[model samples]
Target chain A: MSVTAAKGFTAAGIAAGIKENGNPDLALVVNNGPRRAAAGVFTSNRVKAAPVLWSEQVLKSGQVSAVVLNSGGANACTGPKGFQDAHATAEKVAEVLGRGAVEVAVCSTGLIGLLLPMDKLLPGVETAAAQLSEHGGEKAAIAIKTTDTVHKTSVVTKDGWTVGGMAKGAGMLAPGLATMLVVLTTDAGLENDVLDEALRAATRTTFDRVDSDGCMSTNDTVLLLASGASGVTPDHAEFAEAVRQVCDDLGQQLIRDAEGASKDIKIEVINAATEDDAVEVGRSIARNNLLKCALHGEDPNWGRVLSAIGTTRAAFEPDRLNVAINGVWVCKNGGVGEDRDKVDMRYREVHIVADLAAGSETATIWTNDLTADYVHENSAYSS
Target chain B: MSVTAAKGFTAAGIAAGIKENGNPDLALVVNNGPRRAAAGVFTSNRVKAAPVLWSEQVLKSGQVSAVVLNSGGANACTGPKGFQDAHATAEKVAEVLGRGAVEVAVCSTGLIGLLLPMDKLLPGVETAAAQLSEHGGEKAAIAIKTTDTVHKTSVVTKDGWTVGGMAKGAGMLAPGLATMLVVLTTDAGLENDVLDEALRAATRTTFDRVDSDGCMSTNDTVLLLASGASGVTPDHAEFAEAVRQVCDDLGQQLIRDAEGASKDIKIEVINAATEDDAVEVGRSIARNNLLKCALHGEDPNWGRVLSAIGTTRAAFEPDRLNVAINGVWVCKNGGVGEDRDKVDMRYREVHIVADLAAGSETATIWTNDLTADYVHENSAYSS
Candidate 1:
């Protein structure tokens, strides 16, 4: 179950022939409800995709009746024609659902700088609308994949309400909001403001910390909708927590399915002067190609860690800096400490602790190891 | 001809037992002159190596008698003992040359966070001092190799004077100041302040723009020594031009010999609001891992380049940007333009021209492609 797992929602996924391989490339989710409330987040990249620009405007009304997503072409960098294509896509969805054009959100994820197959996409929206059902979520999730090895979905249920979501992205994942296309739905009674507040709070910590390849996407977007079908008014704290948990689960799935990744690294910056410093230091370490390669080879090279740290402007005494691989302190007081050979790194998960010794603030950044496979996948991706 | 191409300089390189592989690892350069005028620049990294710290102090007097360098172990992060070892090495060189310890400069490269073999290194300096002669710059350049495939040296001769230099570093090369160790010798009669100004201006545009691997080292340094043996007080502009040419030539050599590089990429950002903005944007493009990988595979992926540009805060409108690869305009006005298939990339040198469409300011940054051999070389470097 995905977004359609919630009450008063229906979804359908179909093979639109937009993909040259004839795979499923279109998904539609509709809110069949007495109340329509929605909130969304999009990529902060200045060079945003056409769909991102269109959805940002539609979401301004704080109400959405349906969402149309396709994954054969990103519809980005197509100039003014790309903007027109995204508008036509949203208008097609609105006409099929019998809703206003401004009440439909749109998303596209695939090769950039290419026009969408409007011939296949516009007709596919009509077919998807006719087949929409509450149990059609898993199909919708599977339809929105480009290089992703598996579909990702998460569902959470309480005594009287349920929250469900799905995501699609295997590369170009980094901070600055969602970093991918995610759609979530809940049956709880909530207003647009409450939904927006909860969604922002959840993604601020979850989706904003997953940096798979250090390349932020231009088509990243997240949407959340609410319906009063369950008739349960959830507590604000409880609703926020549920949203965060769902987003966290989806973020982890995205990382696990990251392209050409052999290892998942968790860089935990501890005892920094401020939360921003912790995050800055952590991001620097996560983006160091040399350190990422060392992690891939399972070499406990703490020198690379220190070198990365030295490049940052974080305030700390060089001799007071400490680093640990797994649980062994390979670097203490910024020098050789415990035997690096004693630190075993034969696991898929690598934990790195960088202590800045400035304050109590901390942050954790998720990244993937650099591998030859990563190079191979991305090298020929666009061609 | 390298540093020894300049008059009044003697250099030697010897096989120091400090390297367990029985490779040549020690070099010595002596300024045997009537007038010893010297100036130096060092890495801006807060975590300075012991040799850098010692040499930084030695150059404060605006005079240097001799310079001793070793490449087996980088005497960094070893605390007080490392400083003591660097001081001891310089003291031995000064003792053999009959000069004060403060008149001798020290430099080291190779694995960080390790102690130098003082016994082998101190004796090796004496051997190098005894063998120092007028045409030994090539041998000195070869002795400082860690992962470099070839020795780097450059000479500019003009009007009865010459400026020559040698550099050593294949990775961890980025710009704060000089990101690698270099020794330049000149016979043009000049005062310490004149040489300092000329060297700074030369490197600001030459060596400081080379960002091979985007890693800043703790042991980066560049030294300049003028012996006043030619009795030619060259004009300031002419001397600065000669210095720039020499540094430019050596910098190119460093890029060609970058570890695991199959292609040398020159990212040129033009039409920026300012030179600093241009430099910032160029460096960002040069350091993009995905773009580098695409270059390694000969894929003309302009989306990665656009995504990289979007990450910078430089003043440029998204819709006004244009990019050309190998003289083919793949992207125009921030969108697709000419056929990407028209671009040719079957060469070792690749040029990327990004037009920011903002102003006339421009800058160029040099970098290497990301490859499996780079990963293999850096991963098992210390082991």
Candidate 2:
């Protein structure tokens, strides 16, 4: 169950001939709702794709009836003509759905600096619209995949409402949003203001903290739409919790399927002077190339950890820093403590705890190990 | 020619049994002069090695009699005991040379968080002192090699004066100083203040701009010692230029010898609003893993370059950015320009020019391509 797990939603995925390999490359999700309340977050990168520029304006209206996504060409840095293509695609989707052009949001992924094949894409949109069904969520998830090896979906159901979503990203996963396209649907009868607040709060911790690599994308987008089909108004706090749960689950799935990653690393910074300091320190550790390589080799090299922390502006005395790798406190008070040889790292998951001994603030950032396959996959082609 | 290329200096290198493989691991350089004016720079990383902490204090007097460097272990994150060991090493050198302990500076490179073996190190200082000679500069350079495949040295002879130095580093090379140890000696009769000003100016543009892998070290140190043997004080501007030339040459050597690097990339950011902005954008592009991988595969993926520029806070409009790879403009005005297929990247050196079109300021950064061999080397064992 993907987005279709929630009521009043139908989706479809179809091959659009955009990719030469004949893979499914077009997806459409529509809301048959009494209320079309929505919220969205786009990439923080200043160099945005044409589709992102279109979607940002569509999200400003806070009412989206449908979302059209494709995987082939990013349509980014393509100048004014690319924007026109996005506008025209939205217009076609609106014409078929009997909705306004402004009510349709567009998202694109794949290679940057290339224009989409509008002749094939326009026809594929009509085919996708014809195939729209309640059980098409999985198909839609499968279609919006470029290098992703598997499709991702998450569902969280409460007493009378359900929140569900889908995501696709295998690389270029970093803060300021990973290279991803996520669409969440709910039937909990929420208004635009509530949906916006909940989506922002949920994504701030989930997608914003997952840094598989220190590279941001130009087409990152996360949209949350409410159809109000359940006709049950839940408490705002409870509804926010359900949205956060779904987002957290999807974020984990993205990390598990990260490109060429052999180990999933969880970096937790504790006792920071502030939440921002914790985040800064956590990101510094997450983006350290040497430390990531050492962890990939299962070396438990805590010295590299201390060196990374020292590069940050976070408040912490060098002599007071402590670190634990996989439950072994190998470094204490900036010196050797437990034997590093005693630490076990035979699994796909690695946990590191860095204690600042400064205050009570804490944060966690998810990342992946740097491997030979990562270099090989990213080097072999332009993705 | 190495540090001893100048007059009134003697040096030696020997295996001190600190390295288990019995490679040369200790070096010594002495100033036999009427003046011992000196200036030094160390790593900006806060979690500094014990030798760095000790040498920082030794340089406060603006005078140095000798320098002792080792390659077997980096005594960092070892608490008070490490500091004591650094002090003891200085005392041993001072005793053997009949000088005050405060006049001796120490440097160390290799694995961090481990203590140096004083039993072998102290006796080795006596052996180095006994073997010191003006022709031993090449041997001293070889002794400071950790993972460096070859020892590096540079010399510039001017009108009645000479400047020469040696450096050793293979990885963990980044800004705020690469993981390197360099020593330069000049026979010109100059005071400490003049030496300090010229050394800082030289390093600001040379060593500090070399970012091989974006990983700073805790044991980086560069020192300049002046002996009054030449009895000729050259023009300040000419002296500074000679020093900068030597540093630039040594920095290039470090990048060429970078671990597992198949290509060296030079990122030039031009027409920025300020020098700081140019440097920031250049570094952001230099540290981009995706761009590095693309260049490693000889693919002119200029879109990745645009994406990296977007992440910086530099002053530039997205639609005005331009990028050139190997003199071919692959991206212009933030969109596609010349055909990427026309660009040639068969050589080991790649040049990337980013035109910000904001102002007249410019900066350059040197880095290396991300390779599977890099992962293999860093993962095979701890550095």
Flag clash pairs in model 1.
Answer: none
| Best-performing candidate as measured by TM-score | 2
Model 1: how many Å of interface RMSD? 1.4
lDDT of 1 by residue, B31-87 (tens): 998779998988878888899999999999779988999998989888889999999
Q: Tens digits of per-residue lDDT for model 2 on A205-243?
A: 999999998999999999999999999888999999999
Report chain A TM-scores, every model: 0.98, 0.99
Model 1 docking category: medium
Candidate 2 has which clashing residue pairs, if any? none
Interface RMSD values for the candidates, listed in order?
1.4, 0.7
The residue-by-residue lDDT of candidate 1 on A19-64, one tens digit each, is 9999999999988876789999999777888999999999997799
Badly placed stretches (over 4 Å) of model 1 are B177-179
lDDT of each: 0.88, 0.94
